[model samples]
Target: MKKILPAILLALLFILTASSVGYAADIQMKVDGVTILAEVKPEMKNNRMMVPLRVISENVGANVHWSGTEVALTKNDRKIVLTLNSDKAVFNGKTVLLDAKPYLKDNRLFVPLRFLAQSFGCTVNYSHTTVSVDTKPFYIDGVQVAAVQEEIQMTMGSIVDELQGHAYIETMYNLLMQNKGNEVEAPARISLNVHNRLPGDYDQVVQIDFVGENGDSITSFGLYAEVPSEGEDEGEPKVVIYAETEKRWYAFSSKASQEIWELNAIAGKNGFLTMISNTTP
Candidate 1:
């Protein structure tokens, strides 16, 4: 009877393990309205849903690092640290107990989806077979400038002009030169706004606006500069600018272009101010 009892317990454990696998296979996840097709699918543990760490973190623009049995996630100002098979997690230096501890499944680290999403300021909803996550957009605020500088011609008909203050000014000067016949029109204005979302992984928005002579806006364009957080080596950041007139988006990683665009944005604002001053009574 003792031997038979041992065999019955072993058979029950096998059945439970098979059921867990089947349940995990049916789980799906969606982030920001986009379905995540992770190489390792999500799993269920202790009535909680566990998702692949890399798949979810990358989708939500979080930086993830793994050391031995510990995983670290950083998004903006918040940081989360989780250890394998541990129900305790450190969030921004505060220890919090997790409903379901992270574990390794199929050689991948699976973390509790609801806990992670909420920690990153995202809302999570679960249905029969799907988990949906939504995060609010970041707020943006900034300042602008507009000014003009005189052009100087060097010896032997060589045109040399000092760029005065910022490259944005030079950008504005070029815009004015392109519309030489329309000097009465308000010059293009430049602006720089910071995206306040993820603390360590924020972005800067640079904009250029062209205004009509009657104070109406003509056209507007801008670029987004993605900045990485401290202690992170995210290679080179990216800049994505959309040209409304052309109906196209341009993305690059050239530092020179980024600096020129930033300076030009400031200069553009200054130039517009100058134009207004000249036309005022």
Candidate 2:
């Protein structure tokens, strides 16, 4: 009887864990400083919050253009075209590889909001309770900018319900000089931190700083990336990076370095950093 009782308890625990795999998500709209609730649906295949693209674009006053597998967005006369199934994206007449590809699911085209927002001029914000999408005169630390990307985990289930699911948020960022500005590279200071209520599996926080020449500083920016540690199904990395660039940070296994060593090393000597985080173990 005692052995049978223990086995039953174990089975019950497993069932409880499996059942906690999905939760409700909250959606919001942000114009200026006011935020209101928006519609939300479950993207079953990807487990993402399926938001209405039309509502989002219209609320922000962005003109949307679609042609077969391609979607083009025009705002303030600036244009960005994304083609389905293609890794390359066209922005302002320049061709570049998209960090995240656009896709069509259930008759709806879904693209990463960060890409559209930043390429145009917009910003996205996420908190425990709300996701604020703002598009009017937004700036970071006093710099008037549109669209920046930082990584945050979109909860599959309601936080109040405490559901456990497996998913990851990885982002990529690129900085290009404006119109023959300079071909120089610069040393940059970069740092990443993950914020989560539960202990994250890959709790490793790495920072890198580097130096750059005068022209290099103009092209310097940081990419913040996070990934779930292997074997930890419930863990997710919530990352933030502090540097000069448009936001959208990506997740990767490599350590973070100031002025990004791998990238700068390829471009040769152009930039440098003076001080960095000096925390000892």
Candidate 3:
């Protein structure tokens, strides 16, 4: 793994340090060429760039968890632990001192940008007040991901929302990858988990397209609940995912199925389902 700071970035840091270390209104952050949609904007504090811990970490393919004043971040083989108001950080079990301490702002934990990013083997560059973070391109099933497209499985398929950020894209991808099911002779009765069923399964709630650089879908899949028959009680969970390209089916546990439903429901709430049909004409 590359060390946290390089000479050129150090020089850039010096230039940024000379500026007013307060509001980050002029500072823009981009990861892998996509502007980060951070709930709290990145700010400059104590000559170091402070960014929301979760927002920046997730963008670089790192998972974040907060336990009171302490937060843990992990990606691949690396793990980082930091505490609020402390300059000390544990990287891969080795302790190191940070140039600045992390602090809470508006209930969000903010950490030094370069330190947390480099810990995961990403490069950070500062130019014209925009911080560009470049991470090794993430691939799923050997295909480079460009973005994630969410679609409504209504009468016909209609795209409702899309997310270009690596953080969001990776999340939707994992929901499919992690819950793969055992191969079986294709089920006889496959139903779509939708509000109003399609001619067959039109309204299958979970419709995700992982797009590549050329704006073509690398893979697509849908999931539906396979609840037990009236008499049955114990067996596979309710979720059954079908990978359209591979023509494969997988059964996920009840817990996982519930989570999938919640995810699609959340996406639907943000999409045309909320405004186009629910309230408007």
Reference-based TM-score of each model: 0.47, 0.38, 0.72
Across 111-205, the per-residue lDDT of candidate 3 in tens digits comes to: 99999888877889998788988877658778899867666554434445665555446656776777676754455655544443323231245
* Runs of candidate 1 exceeding 4 Å displacement: 1-21, 138-252, 255-281
Q: Per-residue lDDT for 92 in model 2?
A: 85
Please tell me which predicted candidate would have the highest lDDT against the true structure: 3
With candidate 1 superimposed using the best TM-score fit, by how many Å does residue 22's alpha carbon deviate from the native? 3.3
TM-score leader? 3
Name the runs in model 3 displaced over 4 angstroms: 1-23, 190-203, 226-237, 257-281
lDDT of 2 at 146: 26
Candidate 2 lDDT over residue span 1-281, tens digit each? 99999999999998875654433333444434444333343232243333445544544545679897777877666888888867788998899876666667666666666566666566776665455555554322344332222222222211110100000000112221111122222212222333442233233233221212221222223333335444767333344433445433333323333323443332221111112222222
Superposition error at 265 for model 2 (Å)? 54
Which pairs of residues clash in candidate 3, taking residues 3 or more apart in a chain or in different chains? 198-202
Per residue, candidate 1 scores C-alpha lDDT tens digits across 1-281 of: 99999999999999998987777788887765556656677777778888888766755556788898888999768999999999999999999999998988778888999899899888899887888777644211222222232222222222212222222233443443232221121212222233333433324343455433243434444445556566778766655555546565555344644455455343333222222212112
Rank the candidate models, highest lDDT first: 3, 1, 2
Residue 10 lDDT (model 3): 86
